[model samples]
Target: MRVRKLTFAALAVAAGLSLTACNGDDGTAQSDGSSSSSSSTSGGGSGSGGSEQGGGKDDSAGKSSAGSGSDAQAKAAKCRTDDLDITAKDSTIDGDDEGTVAVEFKNGGGRDCLLSGYAGVDLKTSEGDLSAERSGQESSPMVLKDGESVFFGVTYPLNESGGSGVKVSSLVITPPNETKSFSVEWPGAATLPVTDGSGSSVKVGPMGSAGQGGAS
Candidate 1:
């Protein structure tokens, strides 16, 4: 009877130890699960920070694009006739009877502006006004700051022989994209005759930075 009681006590002790071991294993599993959950939460926070960084980059790019649009909107205005100091002179080729009336435009304003296209020219004669034709050169926009200058030409044949021509006395000049007109006397008005019987021979060229035929 004493041996049987001792055997039964030993079995009970072993069962208790086994149950404790199982509880310990379950606790270890719970700890590992908690660690995994914490790691997952930490990874989620890191991903949120990355999203915020990307958002910041997007905002910066948006501001840069807006600034570029503003810069594009700040282009210069068209040059007005009141902003120019204009002069005209005769440009006779050495041997050819073909001649040019070089019209120089100086920007005398305080701000920068744009100059483009042909100068509206009308040759005033005794019979009637002869309007000059365009020379078919491409007119490009050019910026003219204060004190800058550009030139255009009024080309016509001298018609030294008594032929189909008109004797020009004065010129009515109009700058491009403007309504105001200014007058300058035709250089050598008494001697030179512009052959414009069809009224299409006298031609006006495009504006240039260098001189006549220097349009760009």
Candidate 2:
């Protein structure tokens, strides 16, 4: 009977040890799962933060590109005659320089401007009153952007008559309806053409686009 009691006590002790072992293993598994879950959550948060930061940088770069485009457009904005450079050359070398002249208009300012329609042309003589003639084709204003130029043609005759078919020295030019005149250096040894059997000789054509034949 005593032996039986001893055996029973030993068995009870063994059952308690088995239960403790099982509980300890369960706790260890739970702890490991919790640690793994925490680590995964932290990594996900870091990835999300990195993605947001990268998005912000891309947005900043886009805005910078847009700003540069706007600045370029602003610099290409309107023009005036006072901010222009004017030049002239003889047309039709096959004939007397008295026939036609090619006039070039260039933008000499920091901004762009519009130039269209006919320009007022006149001849200044060393021996007589200035000859003024209003001439040009009626048209719309062409957009003359900064650093751009347009061309036109003018016709005049050479008169070496002993009377008043005056000799030209300088040219007086004006923009349409602006009344502002630009004096151009005349390098021709020709005389102004006689228009009405008199001493006025000047006719201007409308300005043409760049790369045009100067008369269009």
Candidate 3:
């Protein structure tokens, strides 16, 4: 019994010394552990926020680069007559009360080209060449790639008088200020009347955007 009591007393003294030793140390160790954990959390949050910000910046830069590329492409030289393939087709707007033919032009060259203002057109048949005047239309520069096409419209009042007027069978097309001209076949069998006691016969306009045909 005495030996058992001595053993219990020894155990109790050892436990007390352990608790005292823990209490004797400064609180720096505990604070440091908590600080380490806080630092880890703060670092994780900062890193995530930084990643999101960086991603946004990258997206903005990408769009800016795309815009710059488009601006560069928008700057191009005027179209050359030899590098274009022109076609004429029968079309009309505001009903069939008017006679209209659409001029579809494609850039067949290796480089981009620009076109503005009116297209110089002249209707040709066995009789003579009847030049078409401008229709006071305005347009901006249009850019086209190889094999890509743009179109314009040639509109005039339908003359049914059967009077003495120039009969048009074919069209001679020339790009603005270009010497070389392209020959476009007449789209319809109906003859184009140059003038039959009318004030004006035909008018030309600039080529519009790819999907929309414009005339003045």
Winning candidate number (TM-score): 1
Candidate 2: tens digits of C-alpha lDDT, residues 15-54: 9999999999999999999999999978878788999999
Clashes in model 1: which pairs?
none
Q: How many residue pairs clash in each candidate at the backbone level? A: 0, 4, 0
lDDT of 3 by residue, 29-125 (tens): 8888899999997777878899999999999999989878856554678889988888888776555777777888889988988787778888785
For model 1, the local distance difference test gives 0.80
Off by over 4 Å in 2: 1-78, 96-98, 130-136, 160-165, 193-201, 209-216
lDDT of each: 0.80, 0.70, 0.75
What RMSD, rounded to one decimal, does every model reach? 5.0, 6.9, 10.2
Tell me the tens digit of each residue's lDDT in model 1 across 1-216. Answer: 999999999999999999999999999999999999999977877788999999999999999898888676868899899999888887755785677778888899888899878889887887688788999988898898888888888887666767555567898999999999989889833434553465567788888722744322
Error of 1 at 64 (Å): 2.7
Whose TM-score is higher: candidate 1's or candidate 3's? 1
Off by over 4 Å in 1: 1-44, 65-73, 159-167, 191-196, 209-216
Q: In angstroms, how far off is 120's CA in candidate 2?
A: 1.7
Question: Each prediction's TM-score against the native?
Answer: 0.70, 0.52, 0.57
Question: Which residue pairs in candidate 2 have backbone atoms (N, alpha carbon, C) closer than 3 angstroms, thus clashing?
Answer: 78-112, 78-113, 79-112, 79-113
In model 3, residue pairs whose N, Cα or C atoms come closer than 3 Å (at least 3 residues apart or on different chains), thus clashing, are: none
